[model samples]
Structures are given as structure tokens and as C-alpha cells.
Target: MQTKSAARNIFFGGTIFFFVIFVGLVAHSYSYIVTTSTNVKTLTEAVAHGKKIWEENACIDCHTILGEGAYYAPELGNVCKRLGGKDAVMGMIEARQENEEDTRQMPNFNIKGKDLEDLAEFLCWTSTIKTQNWPPNEAG
Candidate 1:
């Protein structure tokens, strides 16, 4: 009788222990979800348009932004900050259209005006993602 009672106690205690662990893990996951969801920036129509442009142009085939896409070109995850601001990004795009010898030889997409603005906005939005300093440094 004594041995049976000890075994029963042990089984119940182990079950409770595991249940508590599972609850803690769930709570932690929920907290992370809440925090990250709140931190995410709201996507606008222009940003969506710019995202479409990025996809249509296959920009990911060359550049890696926020650790997604290809690696042939420089990481543009922080290009806005690196280049100064949105205007700088537009200027670079315009310059790429004019300059024949850009480092990567980006094709002159002739993307201009609002398209340029939208694309820059999209890139800026990507920069704001809370990736925890991904790519390690700006040189990526």
C-alpha cells in the first residue's frame, strides 16, 4: 500500500510540474507575440505598392534586406539610415539612372516621381522591422 501511494504521488507531481512548464512557455510566447505585433509598423497603400515593385523587379534576386532574399548585392535593410534618409534613397535611385558605372550596375529602371517615393517608403518600412540588429552590422 505504501509503495502504491508513493508511485501515485510521484505521477501526479510530475504531471503538475510539466503542466506548469507548458503554461510558462505559453505565457512567454504570448508576451513575445504581443510586443512584436505592437512594434510592427502599419503598412500603407504606397508601401504595398512599393513592395509590389520590389517583387516585380526581383530585387530580392540581388540584394538581401533584413536577412531575406539574395546576397549578390549589398544588404538594403538599413539603406535609408545608411544613405541618410528617403530623399537620399531617391537621389541614389535617380543617380543610378544617370550614372553608368554604379558599383553594382543597377539598371536604370526609369523609376521616378511617385514610384520612386513609394519604393523609398517601402525600403524605409523594411528598415523599421525589429530584427534585433540583424545582419550583425551595416556592411552586410
Candidate 2:
């Protein structure tokens, strides 16, 4: 019931409308990620160094952090809260002992000194991220 020119106008109008909606959604997502999903104030040198160490050692291969890695080990997203504090995390990492009775064991990566401290700091920082109650339990 519409002329060729009217049909063309409707098509272009619809395209523009959808494009604007898409742009608005993208902006919203970006703002949420920058402002709501993370705390920029807590990002420190120690946290960066710890993340670097985590990558260098391939910790993701055995453990899941924020529920992205393998499930072989306990989730470490909320490790700082669950384990008590940074000191407890550091202590656990420092004291890795192999037991024959245990079916699975965490191998000692020999992480120590400032590197160990940084790694713990990184995990503690990760605990502060807003995961919207992810892992669904305190154990994570």
C-alpha cells in the first residue's frame, strides 16, 4: 500500500533507529564495566605484579579464579575472604607439602619473597571485584 519512496524511507528510518539503540547499549555496557564492575582505586603495583606472576606460572591450568579456569582446584575468586586474609593465603602457598595419602596435591612453585606477596595481593584485590555473588558460596 506504500509507494517506492515511502518504503525506502521506512527502511532507512528503521535502520537508523536500530543503530542508535545498538550504540546506546554499547555505551551502557562500557560504563558499567568501568564504573560498576571494577574498583579502579584498588588497582596497585602489587596487584599487577601478582597477575603477571599468575600468568607466568600458568596457575589457570590447575586452579579456577573467578570461575574461568579448570575445576581441578578450589575457586580462588573469594579466597581472601574464605581463607581468612592475605596472610592465610600466603601461608598456604608457602607451605605446600605433598602427602601420599591425598589423591591430588598442589605442587610447590617455589614462589617467595616479593613475588609471593604480590601474588597474594593480586588475589586479595580480585576478591574485591564485584562479581554479583558469583561462585554462589563463600567457599569460592
Candidate 3:
């Protein structure tokens, strides 16, 4: 063990051991994410459509959901709670009116009909996900 080659061997062995551990952890995380993180029951047509709308409208560009996305706007993870349940969530989203006053702000997405309902439903569903406590702040 006192030899230089012995020391080098130990170093390489430790590196390989840590690398294996890291790889194992990554594999476990991937499996867990695939199997447990999402609740498939909550993933309905409405949630899918709502997710599509979110992507199409680039809502993540301004808002964070479940603490993921740009920080420019408030987090929509627990928005159903923040805004007060489904009706309130729907109200806030529906309240956006197009203003021609020349101001830099959240634009009117003009979400209407089923699309509006679906989007709100998606947010409500998101609030119910098992985050183990995230955003950790009143103002996300």
C-alpha cells in the first residue's frame, strides 16, 4: 500500500467505485420517475389538452409550474390553492382582457370554452402532484 503504484491503484479504484455509485443512483432515479412520480389516474384527456395548450402558448416562458420554468411570473404549481380552488383559478385565467393601453405585461391568452376549462383542470391536477413540498415560498 505504501508503493506509488499501490496508491495510484487505490485512487483509480475509488474513482471507479464512486462512478458506479453515481450511475446506480441515476438509474434508480430514472426508474422512480417513470413509475411513481406521476399519478396516471389524474392524467386524462383534459390534462393532455391543457398541457398542449400550455406548450403551444409558451406559458412556461413566463410562469413556473411545480417550481419548474422561468421565474418571471408566479408559480402555477399550487395555483389552484393560491387563487382559491378550481373556480377561482378559472376566474383569474378568464379575467385576462386584451388592453390596448400600450403596456408591457401578461397578454390576454384569450383562453375560452373547453380549452380554458382544460387548462384550469391541468393546473388543478398539477397542484395535487406529490412534490414533497416545493416552491417553498408564498410568491413563486
Candidate 4:
């Protein structure tokens, strides 16, 4: 019963409506990322150095950060917060132990000195990123 012209009008109207909605969502996401997701003020030389170490060692091969890497290891997005800060993070890295019965263990990366400090700083900075409560639990 509908006229051809009316059907065409409906299709065009729906396309435009959806396009507008898509644009709005994209803009909102950009604004959120620029304003709330990351802290540029805290990105320091140490953090950059830590990130370089992370990449050089291929840490992403075993661990997930911000939910983006392999799931073989625990997510480290909030490790600084969970473990209580930079010193604790370094301690855990330095003191990693392997139980005989455990099938999986974190190998000692031999990270020390300024490298250790920088890596900790990187992790702490990562912890500060707003993930909207990702990993969903304290264990990650």
C-alpha cells in the first residue's frame, strides 16, 4: 500500500539518521580519549625508557597490558595499583620464584638498576590509564 516515493524517503531518512549517530559516537570517543583516557603530563623519560624495554624484551608475548596482548600471563594494566606501587612492582620482578610443582612461572628477566626503575615507572603510568575498570577483578 505504500507509494514508491514514500519508501525511498524512508530509506534515505534512515541512512542519514544512522550516519549522524555514527559520527556522534566517533566524536564522543575521540573527546573521551583526548580528555580522560590518558595523562600526557605523567609521560616522562623513564616511562618512555620502560616502554622501550618492554618492547625490546617482547613482554607482550607473555603478558597482556590494557587487554591487548596474549592471554598467557596475567594482565598487568593495574599491576602498580594492585601491588601497591613502583617499589612493590620492582620487588616482585626481582624476586620472582618458580615452584617445582607449578607448570608455569614467570622467568627472571634480569631487569635491574635504572632499567628496573624505568620499567616500574612505565607500569605505574599504565596503571593510571582509565580503562573503565577493565580486567573486571583485582587479580589482573
Candidate 5:
């Protein structure tokens, strides 16, 4: 262990061992994602589009989803259930589209029609996920 050669061998061996472990962990995580997480059947093209729309709009900046994101706005993980349904969700978004009110500074994104509907669908999809009873409140 005192010799330079022995020290180098130990360093290289540990590096390789850790690298293998990292690769194995990555593989295991990928397998779990493919086999256990995400209901792929529910991920229709519309849902993907809705997710894209959500990202583009940066809704997470304002609202929380599944206990993630900023705390500025209300948690939206179960918004569909709390608000009533997708239609109600749509109503809220549509109402915000051309909003001219001088209320809390939620800027108008002008989202309407199919785009709004698709966003609602994405929100509804999130509502149905198994969150182990998160948001803790039925009003979320």
C-alpha cells in the first residue's frame, strides 16, 4: 500500500469498480422506468402535446404539480378532482386567456381552443397518478 505502484493499482481498481456500479445503476433505473413507472397507454399523442405546451408555458414556475415546482400558485396535481373535472379546468384556463383584470399578476398566455383542451387533458392525467395521497388536502 505504501509503494507508488500499489497505490496506483488501488486507485485504478476503485475507479473501475465505481464506474461499473454507475453503469449498473443507470441500467437498473432505465429498466424500472420502462417497466414500472409511467402509464404509457395513457400517454397519447395529445397528452404529449399537452405536456409540451405545459413546458413551453412554464406552468411549473407558478404552480406545484405532484409536490414539485414553485409554491407561488396552488398545487395542480389533483386540480381536476378538486375543481370538478377537465371541463372546469378548461374553463379556468380559457378565462385566463384574454384576462384584462388588474388582479394577481397572472399574465395572459392567450391559450384557447384545442391547445387549452389539451392542457386540461394533461392536468387531468396528472390528477389520476398514484401520489401516495399527496397535497394532503382534498382541496388541492
Candidate 6:
């Protein structure tokens, strides 16, 4: 009688443990799906246009953004903030165009007005993404 009772208790306890784990996993998955779907709709038209420019220019070929590209140049994930602001970033780009020195050659794309604004907005948006403090330091 004692042995039978011990076996029944062990089986029931194991079943309950597995059931709880399965339920938790399902709940976590549902929450993740909902959150991701909501965030996906938050992307604006400017961001979409900036994405196209980034792609067309092959910016990732040299610079890494959020650690997803080549490492030849500085990571531009938080460049907007690092440069002080969106306008400052545009100024820096414009300056690079005017200077054109061999020491650091960032070719002037001649991006102007709305294009610059959209690009800057997209970069600012990228900087706000949660990356757990990627690039590890301001130097990136």
C-alpha cells in the first residue's frame, strides 16, 4: 500500500510540473507575438524612405548599425545623439562634402532638405531602439 501511494504521488507531481511549464511557454509566446506586431506598425514613412536610402547607398557595406554590418567604419546606431542632434548630423555630412580630405573620406552624398530630414529622423528612431546598450561604448 505504501509503495503504491508513493508512485501515484510522484506521477501526479511530475504531470503538474510539466503542465505548468507548458502553460508558461504558451503565454510567453503569445505576449511576444502581440508586442512585436504592435511595434511593427509604429514605423513611419520617413523611416521607410531612410531604409531605402540606406539600402541603395549600401551604407552597411562600411558601417555597422546595431552590429548588423561591416566594421570598417563607426557603428551608426546612435550617431544622431553622438553628433549632438539631427541638424548637427546633417551639418557634419555637409561639412564632409565641402572638405573632402584624404585623412577621413566620407563622400558627400549631396543629400539635401527633406532627404536629409528623413534620414536624420530614421537615424534618430534607430537610436531609440532597445539594444541593451550595444556598441559597448561611445566610441562605437
For TM-score, the strongest prediction is 2
Candidate 4 runs further than 4 Å off:
1-26, 97-103
Q: What is the TM-score of each candidate against the true structure?
A: 0.71, 0.86, 0.73, 0.75, 0.77, 0.68
lDDT of 4 by residue, 16-122 (tens): 99999999999999999879999888999999999998898888998999888988987889999999999999987776633435457777678899999999999
lDDT tens readout by residue for model 3, 67-137:
77988878999898788888887887866545646644778888888998899889988887778777687
How are the candidates ranked when ordered by TM-score, highest leading? 2, 5, 4, 3, 1, 6
Query: Could you tally the backbone clashes for each prediction?
Result: 0, 0, 0, 0, 0, 0
Quantify all predictions' global Cα lDDT against the true fold: 0.82, 0.89, 0.84, 0.89, 0.84, 0.78
Candidate 5, residue 139: Cα displacement in angstroms equals 5.1
lDDT of 2 by residue, 1-140 (tens): 89999999999999999999999999999999899989889999999999999999989998899999988888988999899899999998776533446556887788999999999999999999999989798766
Candidate 3 segments whose C-alpha is farther than 4 A from its true place: 1-23, 98-104
Clashing pairs in 2: none
- Return the lDDT, model 2, position 96: 53
- TM-score for predicted model 5 compared with the true structure: 0.77
Runs with alpha carbons beyond 4 Å of true place in candidate 6: 1-42
Candidate 5's displacement at residue 117, Å, is 0.8
- All predictions: root-mean-square deviation over Cα? 4.4, 2.2, 3.5, 3.3, 2.8, 5.7
> Per-residue lDDT of 29-123 in model 5, one digit per residue for the tens?
88876666556678777778888899999999998888889888888889999989999999987765655576466668888888888999999
What local lDDT does model 3 show for residue 14? 99
Preferred candidate (TM-score higher): 3 or 4: 4
| Candidate numbers sorted by lDDT from highest down | 2, 4, 3, 5, 1, 6
lDDT of 1 at 55: 84
Runs in model 5 lying further than 4 Å from the true structure: 96-105
Score candidate 5 by lDDT.
Answer: 0.84
